[model samples]
Target: MDKIINWGILGCGNIANKFATDLQTVSGSVLRAVAAQDLDRAQNFAKKHTVERAYSNYTTLVNNPDLDVIYVATTHNFHYEHAALCLAANKAVLCEKPICVNAQEARKLVELSREKDIFLMEAMWTRFLPAVIRLKKDLDSGIIGTPQLVQADFGITKPQEAGSRFYENKLAAGALLDLGIYTINFANIVFGSHPERISGYAQFTNQGVDQLSTYNLLYSEGRQALLSAAVALPTPHQARIYGDKGRIVIDDFYHPQQYQIILNGKKPQQVDEIFDGFGYLYEAREVQQCLLGGKTESMICSLDETVAIMQVMDDLRKQWGLRYPNEN
Candidate 1:
């Protein structure tokens, strides 16, 4: 019999709800409990997700002996702290992307996870999608001769509300953290390494958040990636990987359901991945596999890779002179 992996969710937010919903789709995972700052909100979320318990205190959820793991679905600013708390409790963690606000905290979390002998992975869901998995296998099989470039953009039009995390610098709100990281991860996967040089610019909102941003990554051997993200606009959310022999195009790349590989002198080979409910299941399944296998880190998205990715973002933020209020 498969060991059931009970999960405790920290932060009953939108992403947390999606995760809880997706838990129903995984074979060995169950949403045992959820925690939010507001007790009433936590109870309501538990009722909505049919979870057995809710807590207003995060530590209580983390220390729940029944849960095998904890998913940190909080805002960017709280990822490090909340994930640290869970790790201290000897709980496995699947933190949402960006992992933390910057690379420094990312390093701390990675080190702590190792010291505690606990599982830890940045929930970079794009890396685990079926289309993405097939894409990697094809790329490795030389379908696209040599990946030369990657291009992608994720943009959404959100209101500039003052207290909203998307527009608050103190809360680490910005297109770069919320959206651009997807493009960065796409580039990293295509190139298989960090860019040699990074150049970028951004349009900042009056609230001190990036409204829209574009960046260029220069790699060795003249390889490159161009990407963009915006919070006040809507883009096609498309991605394209240009190779020496062909190109792969992904529509709605971040949460892609379909992709096509256009090879030289051949019809476009396309693939459509159909799945039930939210796409978060793939990552959740990865966590389940890791726990079942007694693994402390994800093979698909390793902690070293998360730190490297965070370092890239840190470098970019340093160049742009973008510092959150929490960071000195």
Candidate 2:
């Protein structure tokens, strides 16, 4: 029999709800506990997901001996602290994207997880999707040859408001961390190293948060990646990779529904995979599988990869003079 990993959620937000629903789609995993700042919210989430325990305080939830892993679904700014707490309790953690506000904090979390011998992974869920897996296989098979240029973009329109996290610097709200990390990580996965050069620009909110940004990265091997993210407009969320022999295009790349591989002077072939509810099931299953295998980090999203992605974001921020209060 497969070991059933007990799962705990540290936030009751929309992302947490998606993860809870996906947990139901996979075996060898159970949603056991949930924590939220508000008691009623926590209770509601727990009851909705048939979770066994609910707490208004995170510390109480982390101390639960039954939980095998804690999913840190908090906002970008809170990921590091929440993940650190779970690690301190000797529990595995799957933190949401942009694992920390900066590379320094991400490095700290990685070190602590290694020191404590606890599993910790950034929840860059896209990397685990079937479509992405297929893409990686296509690259490895030499169908695309050596990738030379990769492009990806994600954007969404948001209302300008002082309290809106997308426009608030205090919340670490910005296109770079919120949306661009997806493209950056995608590039890293395909390119297999940090870019040799990074240059970018952004449009800032009245409060100094990035509303939109575009980045260009140059690699030592003469490769390049063009990436963009925005919270002020809507885009197709598409991605494409150009290699020496062929190219691959992912429609709606961030949450792709379909993709195509094109070879020189050959017809474009379609590659597609249908996802179960919410597409979060893949990452949840990954965590369960890793725990059952007694692994400390996911092969799909290792700590090294997480840190490398953060380094890219940190460098871009420094170039653009973007800083959150917590960064100081």
Candidate 3:
């Protein structure tokens, strides 16, 4: 049996808590430590997870010799620096979504991971879910032949507060990066290529952050994707793909609890798959498998895919006039 990977968490946030809980469900993984900007926060997270070490500073956590991998659960703008620190310390990294603020930062991280010969993967948990895996299989099987259109949407009602990260321009918080990334990723999976022409518009909050947006992605092959996201409304969070022979509709697609496939005007077929431990288990298993096989990146969500996704995000931001403070 291979040795278990000791995971260190940077940023004791809600996502980090979910990851830690899911880590317990994977066999060859263990949460060894955590770090937060506040000492009390780190200690509290460590206590909750029963981890051995907690550091108030991320640098100290990255330098811990006992850790085999570091999960960067920091905000979008900080992903680059935190992931880079872990990679520089010769530790593998599993970073949260929107891997970096833009394509430039994502490309740099990919390059550094290669030069350092360390494992690194974006934590796009939705892709690893069982429903999504099955959806990919159905697409490959041509159940949906020559996909023509892909539609997806995600949204949430968040209160507008100046200090809240969701409405803060300095934190790179917006409907596009937070909610739209999921819709865009789903579209990319169905289309299998970056859109040749991308256009979008957004409604911004008083704080200069986008509160809602809609995007239209047109591919060279004549396929189109209509994606929408919002921070002030409740969307189905569903997706649909239309093809020549049939169609597949993913209910709650981003984190689907159930889905159905309709073929050539026939009856709908339902798919039911239950997830265990907050749905982060699948990604954890992927990380364990990658480490055991000595691979530098996940084939499913490779560095190239992450960079491509970020490029789409950058283009959308350009259209909406959204810019992070760090970019200036």
Q: Please give the distance, in angstroms, between residue 238's alpha carbon in candidate 2 and its true position after superposition.
A: 0.7
Q: Estimate each model's TM-score.
A: 0.97, 0.97, 0.98
lDDT of 2 by residue, 1-328 (tens): 9878999999999889988998898988888899999999999999999988999999999999999999999888888899999999999999999899998999999999999889999888889898888788888888889999999999999888777878888889999999999999888878877898999999888889788999999987889999999999898898999998989999878777679999989999998887888899998888888888888999899889899889999999998999998676
Q: How well is each residue in 3-69 modelled by candidate 3, as lDDT tens digits?
A: 8899999999989999999898899899999999999999999999999999999999999999999
What tens digits encode model 1's per-residue C-alpha lDDT throughout 87-142? Answer: 99999999998899999999999999898899999999989998888778888888
Query: lDDT (0-100) at residue 207 of candidate 2?
Result: 89
Candidate 1 C-alpha error for residue 65, in Å: 1.2
Clash list (residue pairs), candidate 1? none
Worst 10 residues of 1 by lDDT: 269-278
Give candidate 3's TM-score: 0.98
**Model 3 Cα shift for residue 138 (angstroms):** 0.6
Native-vs-model 3 lDDT?
0.90
